[model samples]
Target: METIVPNWPAPARVRALSTTRDGGLSQGAFAGLNLGAHVGDEAALVEANRGLLQQAAGIPGRLNWLNQVHGIAVHPVSNEYDGAPEADAACAHEAGLACIVMTADCLPVLLCDRAGTLVAAAHAGWRGLQNGVLEASIKAMGCKPAEILAWLGPAIGPSAFEVGGEVRDAFLAEQAEAVAAFIPSANEGKWLADIYQLARLRLARAGVSAVYGGEHCTFSDRERFYSYRRDGQTGRMASLIWLAE
Candidate 1:
């Protein structure tokens, strides 16, 4: 039931935390609070672990889990929202409506307004970042971008996240400054990309500069995170945000 609370200056009524691979009933590769039901973990185990998370975290309402497809579909979730929608980002303005995204190595960006009236969570893999997931999420908030506070949750670090040239090219096309985020890796024709910086660049472009929590590396921190790149059949940690009652 271990969780990493976001280190940002969000309002007191905003509740959010990024889960770690610790203190759960999951065994083997999916060990320790594996909340993702779509990652080949045992359905019963995943369900039970999710229940443990709800009880331990005291989430006020049902978590709106999205069937993430690495796309930029931004879903607006309410307390009554049901079913796992095919979306990569979710936003909520209602109190107790938790907006959550599960990730192993992909970046989970949790966002809330400074006033705590709106909250959102986005799953940003390379494709999602390159496309416009963060931008879409912020736009869906229906607030001024400057009023949003964002936290970049644990994901694969640049040292561990190598990518093909196409990935680098895609980002550069979106923002020239993205060049600073990529460097030549040892592998020929490959580049190491800092997803955190790329995400920051995207946020900046969308007028969101108040960002935090870009330190943790899931790939390198095997003891606390489940990395799909480090472990193919792995569990998923969740980053969730909700407006407290």
Candidate 2:
């Protein structure tokens, strides 16, 4: 039932939380609080865990879970949903409607405007960040970027996430200053990429200056969070937000 609430100064009605892998019924590798239905955990276990999540968060409304593909697509949600939609991000304008995304090592970003009329959750993996997932989510919210606030949830840290030269090159191609986010690892052409820094840079470029919570390291903290790189067959955590009615 443990959850991490955003520390940013979002409006009072802007409710948001990021779940940890600490309080659910899945066993074995997908041990506790595993909310990802597509990650090979027994369907029933994940469903039950999700129910626990609803009660713990006091959502008071239906959850609109998504089929995150690590792409830039942003789906809009209301109180009703036909099924989990295929999108890396979800935006909500309706009160009591939540926008959520699942993640392990990849970054989970929760966003809302100062007025709190809109909210969004995005799954920002390396590819998706490079391609523009956060920007797309921000654009979908239809708010002035300056009025938007972002909270960075758990993710693989720079010290633990090493990447080949191409990955560094990919980000550099978009913004040369992105080179600052990469430091040459011990491996000849490999680099330790700082996902938090990269995300901050992107948010700043997108005109979002008020950002918070890039402090959690999922790979290192096996107890509180899940990590795909730390464990291949691991559970996933949920980062969700909604407008309180």
Please, what are the lDDT tens digits per residue for candidate 1 over residues 79-152?
66778999999998888888889999999999988888999999999999999999999999999999989999
Where is model 1 poorest over a 10-residue stretch in terms of lDDT?
A: 55-64
Q: Whole-model Cα lDDT per candidate?
A: 0.92, 0.93
Model 2 scores a TM of 0.98
| Reference-based lDDT, residue 87, model 2 | 94
Local lDDT at 3 for model 2: 89
Q: Which ranges of candidate 1 are over 4 A from the true structure?
A: none
Number of clashes recorded per candidate? 0, 1
Alpha-carbon deviation at 161 in model 1, angstroms: 0.5
